[model samples]
Target: MNILLKMLLSMSIASVILIPLVWFLKKVFGQFLTKRKSYYAWGVVFFFLIVPFAFFFVQKNTEFLWGTPSEFAGLTSMVIGQNGIEVERSTQAVIFQFIMDYVWVLWLMVGLIMLVYRIASYRNFKKFVISGAHYIEEPDELDILAEAMETIGLNKPVEVMINPLISSPVFFGFRREIIVLPSTSFSKKELYHIFLHELVHCKSKDMYVVFLAQIFTCIYWFNPLMYWMIRQLERDREYACDESVLSYLPARDALSYGDTLLHSIVKSGTYKESHAAVSLHENAKMLKERLEAIASYKKGKKGYISFLLLLILLTLIGILLNFYEAKAFIYEKKQGIEIKKEDTSKKTEFRAIDLQNANQDVTIRKGKTESFDLTTYDENSKAELVVKNGILMYKNANPNTQSAIIITIDADKVYDSLSIQTTGTQIKISDIHTKTMRIKGGVIIAHFNQIKADTINVTTGSANVHLTDSEVNKGMKFNGNNALIHFEKSSFNNLEMTSFLSAKLNDLNVQGGLSINSGGQLDARNITTDTLKLIAGNSGNMKFQNTFVKKSSEFQDNESMLLQFDGVLNGQTRMSIGPSQTKFVIRDKMQKYAIDAQSSQADTFILNQSIVNYPFTQNLSAPNNITLTNDSPFNNNFNLSFEE
Candidate 1:
């Protein structure tokens, strides 16, 4: 249904742009277009109207241009919860969604109404014409019809009838051709001319064109230009049929044909047009123009080929631009360098360690004595390991080597500083004490277990970092892009984490404060912090379960956010959300907390599963205070619940 609506919208917009352009080109280069070519130019409009469906079909069948790595699906699902958590929606959001879900039904209803009305009208007109009609039994009329069919090169048999109800000569029916003429006396030459004109319409399949135009008009009933285009096409059909008849006649017979048209117009009444039929004379409004066109008809140059090609090219370009998909590239691991299994251990005395540009798995642990072991991938690859001024510095010359170069370091003494930087490396550190430690890499996988540090910082691009059973005395900081950071059973004095992707913290305890800025999802469970500050952007979500803040805490998001607190709130917390939904669920109902929530009138706030008018407040004098504010004009949904 969504695809159908999109196709209809595309067709409508394209018609608006192309219809007028075709009309203008015809007017500007009218002399260069023959009547047949001018009528056929409308085919461009019809082609573009159906082009969107072609794009939809191609996208569904082929993977040539739209092939993407499947890993991105996992990544996206991780960033957004896979279980599809339900979130409250504002009134405006609900209305907008309702419209999107049922707008097609409305369009279909209108289109059906137009179709049924057109069919009924056509049926009534057909009945009225057939009721007052009789088959031509005159031998002279039959001979004239045979002569006209032969002149127009029409092999199919046609039924000729005379109807006293209609004033003009018209042809109807698709499978069996029927030509209905007014019940009036005519000379042999005039009868021959009228028969030739209607037969030309039959040979050209002008009724099919009118039928198609009627269907399109029904489909695009909301577009006024559709009606205009159909009217214009009807006029063009008559002119082209006239031109075809003139081509079959002698040059002097043009005057006789013009007289017959004028006579039909003089006798013509306010007869309604039927899409299922083609008439010789339309109306007085188009009669003068038709007579002038007949008098001035000449073989014109076919110069619209370039214009038609240009229209097609533009339409193709539009399709390509609109339907282009993003391509995702997958990373493949290369195998070339060899790993040496033999460990080369060396005694080293250093207070600080620094390793840079190492493409390998590295482990650092505590030992009784200070020593280092090197496991090289390539023996020829020179690696710099030196101790200078109480600092151990290591650099790998061939950092681009594919295989692992494991460097396990063991030190008994607590180091003043420790730093490691690499690209696409796996690092593990355990039971090492340091005043300050920093790790930086690209596409890194790092783990810290039972490690103690005064200050620790880690930065990476497209990485996964885990900290388990670790403690930081001073502060810890993490910055990453397209990365996932996880903390389990970790304690820190002041922890600050920033991720462009996702982060999960479980069983984490912060002595001082905890701060997190995420561009995706952030899930924290069993977390205890003295002070908390969290900022999320671009549809980022933060879900906190069994989490407690001791001091003042602030949470802000530019998009949708979900915060679940199963524990007690001990601080003055402030939540600022944007146009998206924000859900707050507190399972500890016994924990008394004051709430002050404010938002625009368009927003909806549900408290304890019931809609509450805002700016709403409750338990204002309570010790624990919580403030929620969303002032965007768009719908901002707030679901606040307290469950025992």
Candidate 2:
């Protein structure tokens, strides 16, 4: 996933789950919490957004590295002495920009906001005792504070408004609203329950909590986790506030208050305020917990030991999630001109992965073959990596879009890294194997640990070529048109091809025989190898182009290698042979050569027509050679040469 998406997803999940969870937990536990802790509880919740927040910062860091390509004004730092003209190298600028994107110290800002909001909500102390406002006209009849807004003082004073929803005198929370009850029907004990309950909300400033919860919710609207969290907080909040009120009431009064609580709980409704830090009314789940709190109230201070344990549990969770916040990002798009930033990392080797590409299908089994008939290949015809260890085999596995594969590694463990470029690369499971890959164009580069692939092919194309550390196995063949092939430390059995195509195997130890097949010619320069075999047919030619070699890795066992040339050569195919022995069997085209076998000592010769130069080193022969004149030994009267 891209950084933005990761951040957004994290934030949304935490906020969505946290909101309702907080609400529900607070509804159950709110009565037990000291007012300050409830606000602190909320402040602690937004603290969880840090991980998602990192996503936003990392992306901004990337953008800073690569500014808009079509630039106009320079930043103040670049203004030095000219007309604000400054040029930044892309790599250096990006790295420096990452440093300048300084997001590390910003997380404390969320912490600071929480601290400041909590403090400001309860900054001053004010005390008030006033007769209830006539609230019978409005629901939350106790909400007469809204009607008496002009006269209501900061001092905690009851502006009695009857709850139109519930006539029972139950305390509903609003900032600085110390709502007084009417003396006509209410006893001192019933009135006391209302005063202490709402006072706790005002003191805790939970009215501001909804605001804080909403900010996180809005940012991570997509996350169910965050939403779940929010609901839990709200539920706990109510329970905590209820606990505070019960602390001052008699058991009889607590029972009396329970009736009013149950009545109001059933009739509760929502408040229409978008402000942060304050929440009104209960969610469906929160309402259930609030009703349960009336019956579930345990009057005893949770065994001093349990409270200590609870504190310890809270402290540990705080330490973990506090330092690491789940972060989310918000982006605003600009119109008209576009700013694009592309970041790329150097490709590193991961484990080996396999893919089928345009040049070769690396058959899974030895000497196995599979083919795709759609011959019109293009650059966009991407190959799929059947087995992907990491991003090395497939571009789809990477999040950054730039193609690279990074392995997931243990801290100190070692892993092997391998890569392959897909053009004219082949593989054989056993020794002395040849698999011809026909490439219309492109160079193939591949790597293997011990015994890997067989050969590589280069075909005609309107492009320049470059190959490094490329190799092919023994007994491999190359056949193609006017293509330029380059190699370094490359292994091959016998090189033969047609046209102006040439491969400069620059490595000092090139073991296999080098030959130019007769259909076309190849000119290799500074190319040195052992047991050079050259063949030509009519117009084919392979020139020295001056190639040299020091020593050659000799052929081991007879079963270890095979170099067979079945193609017909028309013109001169020549090579400077090194001291190693390589057998060459040329089977066809007697008319193309002047049979030069008489010049070299023979090991075994079957000169039906084709010739092998300097035969003292190894065997040179043909398969079946037969000729008949007017009177032959086998056929006395039949002339196979002179047709009737």
Candidate 3:
């Protein structure tokens, strides 16, 4: 599940829970809340609708450091065969990827359409009102507007317009306040009440609140409760404005204000309210409640302070709950399996083991007796474990099951061979001795810790292999499509790796030789090998750091591959770089080497920070030889310097 989608779903769920709670509270304790405070309560509901965007931004900015990349994020698996590298993707995976890619785009397109339609509607309404309206020039009306502004403590200039098309008084515009009124005959007191109501709306900035509500409605258009919430919010805004207008007037005029509201309701059919504007009259249905609220209104103590504190506390709790609900929903959506643990111990003697078709985490270690611990979805998903013909075989019938399976082999005897083949599993092995070991998988994440093995072979489509504090007495070979291979504080007699996409090697010590053939990038650091050979077939750059090649080393690239070496060369080194730049930094300044450079086209060679013309030859008789050859149509550049 996408993080944004999870957050949105969580927000919707929280709104569903919160909207009803607000209604229940208002219905039960309507008198305890001032109209203004009740209006502010709706802000809590808006918080859930708007806070998901904040989570989305945070998720995007921190994704590289904290998020787990999808297994198929940028991986194109290829298998090397007689016909060369062939791209491989399952039909189900391809269809799933296609669907997942377009679902979010569809969601965004619909949301944008809703938003644009609402905005366009509001703009058209504003334009229509302005086209049919004119400034109020009557002296008495100007005096009334000035007095209303003064009563509301508003210093900003307001435009009062008389629109013959509108029936009720409308408050519009965000930056420029416009109060549009119909050319209807009313008493002086009724006119004053109307002017005061719209002016109070402008002072309180209710237009901006209505705009925010419209945006929220567009974003959560799929949630039916959001529409109801918006309606409730508008009702509260009018109620709060009525309360404020009554505060500025005397107690005796409250009945007069109620009469003005009734008059506006009678004339409400001529104009429909917009999401971008606040009107003095909504409809006849809500007019009765507004009149009742006005009749029963009172100047209460500062009880809103306590209500605000409680609202803040509830908002915090709601945010926390939404976060957890999102996380749990994502977890359940991704891993829709229930796990049960089963542990079994056996004293059967076996010299070899074979585990296959596991789609879960598996841990193998040396123990007193042969024991198997399984964490699977159900009993039907358990593995078949038995010893036959000196080989302990373990197999999972349901290859798609995802969980944990741990096996402990007897440590008294060294196994002759141990092989494991899995689909999507993380394998961990430690403190076990085996003559030969083989691991094959589609997506493998294996960690080897302090294991003694004669030979280790790993083949996978995509893998992240980590060998730390381990030893391979004979040799180690790895063949994969996309791999991140790391050997830290590990020794190997010989290491050979063949990858299709890219490979990363780090902190390895080889006694005999190191060979790498990659179609993509190859990065090796802190490596010590007697001999080294690297061949890249594609446009992947090769980088080596702190690598010491003792005997002879050869590096070749079929395409334009940048070669960067910052290491020591004990004997002879040859580089065949085609139009790409090359940089070599000698770690041992005292080691002398002769350079033989050749190029088919123009080439630049820099020796000890000085440019040298090629074909360049220096000290050809020296024991340590460095040969550089370039056969390219473009100019090739090479730089050689001693480490500072």
Candidate 4:
């Protein structure tokens, strides 16, 4: 839960940065971007919006979780315990922490209200467009509309209505397509221009674009710049329509069309105030811009360049918003503890450590130079520490005793092979680099940081693993049950993780194969792997996101597992979900795959290929097996197998 809150908080900070960038780009390049293309650029914000959440999900160094343990205990009773270990906080810290904890609820409430309002308004507008509308059958008007449709290559049937209540030409309705024009009589030329304009909208599918823009605006309403961007998008969409309409007319007729638009300005209602339909005459200001654009419209090669430039700029902005650097840590005995970068050019190899029978919280961090320190809160506690042959050992002199212990290590040491064996000890190690690191523990809280190892082997009974800013060169594996592993912003050559409880790997770069055998739950996000193999025995939920599995991968599971994928599924991959339900929410552009599977019980397969909205689940029963070939043109190349 704290991790989730941290993500939201990071998003808020990113919003502050992105909002200004968005507005600045609009102001500077507003004129360079092509009309329709500029509207599409607004979609870039949707991508940037997710960038922060993804970034923070990986980096553990954040202000929200920083500080001494005792300084944070009072903010929540959950952190307080019956043992009377109290951590005091200043009033300002408490207030700030409280807001950080609960701000997501506020954000959710605001977004929901905006979503409901947009939906209700859409329904009401649909109703208004439906009731008391009379279809126009004038021979001349019908002929003009038919000619406009033919010119735009639209053969689909449509409804043309004369509605006195409507102030301007409007387009709505999906199944029963309708165009509501003002009841005022029009000359042949004006009517032709109006039909052509609305037909251009129909041909370009601007209505759907407008609707999508509205939905995104509502969801991100907290960002005021999004509102500004939406308004610009609507303007650009109409401008594009105007340009298209002029393309079908003679160059000399451009001014005449502009004159028609200017005349419609007075008769057209303030459609900008209405979010229901794409209508003519947004307001007098937009009307002037449309006239100017129409007057200066010409065929050119500059539109392509502007489009390319816009794409490049948006891509850079996205990268910058999500970029995070590794922070440095340097501590000295005189100044207590401080986080600062320093050169480790003259560092020695890291020392080894062995821990036995630790039941209290243990912290290990970096120091200035070659040194070691051990401190305990309870003097009478039977905890003893010794360093022999460069191997630091911690022991409890009494058999049945436990107490808080702090072990500080020098930051400059680079251990060649470091190993740890703990029993019920909560250990935190940070700011040390090593060649190889291994751990075998039981029921502990272990936090590791800035540790580079060739191989990391973690074997625990029941534990919580929080590791960040680390790298494993050759391979890393986990063997445990009832363990919660949170490994973030780490790189590894190969990963072999097996647990009966749960594990989450976030923002990791894995260059080799990944194998997971779990009986509980598994959640991985922002990951990149060469190949994957998963096996689950009992009921659990598995999720993968923003991950690339390039080589062959397979999953064999017998229990009912809820499997979900929100990223790209590449390479030759297969999954046997057994009787469990598997859902693939494809967010990648290049989609292609193959799946060979078998099922003993009744199985259902769902595929959503349509790009209109989210793909719907298509359930199909397969008693024995189902072969999904790569020849399909559905959602790229996605393959999986299942059995029960």
> Could you say which candidate leads in TM-score?
4
lDDT of 3 by residue, 320-345 (tens): 76666545434211232222334333
Cα lDDT of model 1 by residue, 517-603, tens digit: 877788889999999888777777778888878878887876655544455567698988776666766655524789998875656
In order, candidate lDDTs are: 0.76, 0.40, 0.78, 0.67
What TM-score does prediction 4 earn?
0.48
Using TM-score as the measure, what is the rank order of every candidate, best first? 4, 3, 1, 2
At residue 138, candidate 4 shows an lDDT of 82
| Model 2 lDDT per residue over 1-644, tens place | 23343454444444544445545554456456543355355554566554443333434322321223234222223333556545444566555555434432343355456556544443321111122234444344344333323222224554454323322233334544534332324434444455456556665566666556666655554455656666656665666777766665656565676655544434443222222322223444654556566666666654444334444554455443322442222333434434344542223333333332334423222122221122223435443333333323432222112222222222232223223333443421212122333334343322221222455444544223443443455444444345554545545555554443444445423565555543233345456565444443333333343343222221111111112222223233332221212233333444423333221222233233333233322212432222111111121111011011
Specify the poorest-scoring 10-residue window by lDDT in model 4.
325-334
lDDT for residue 384 in candidate 3, whole number 0-100: 66
Q: Candidate 1's C-alpha lDDT?
A: 0.76
Best by lDDT: 3
Distance (Å) between predicted and true CA of 167, model 3?
3.4
Model 3 TM-score (2 dp):
0.47
RMSD of 1: 27.4
Number of clashing pairs, model 1? 0
Error of 2 at 563 (Å): 99
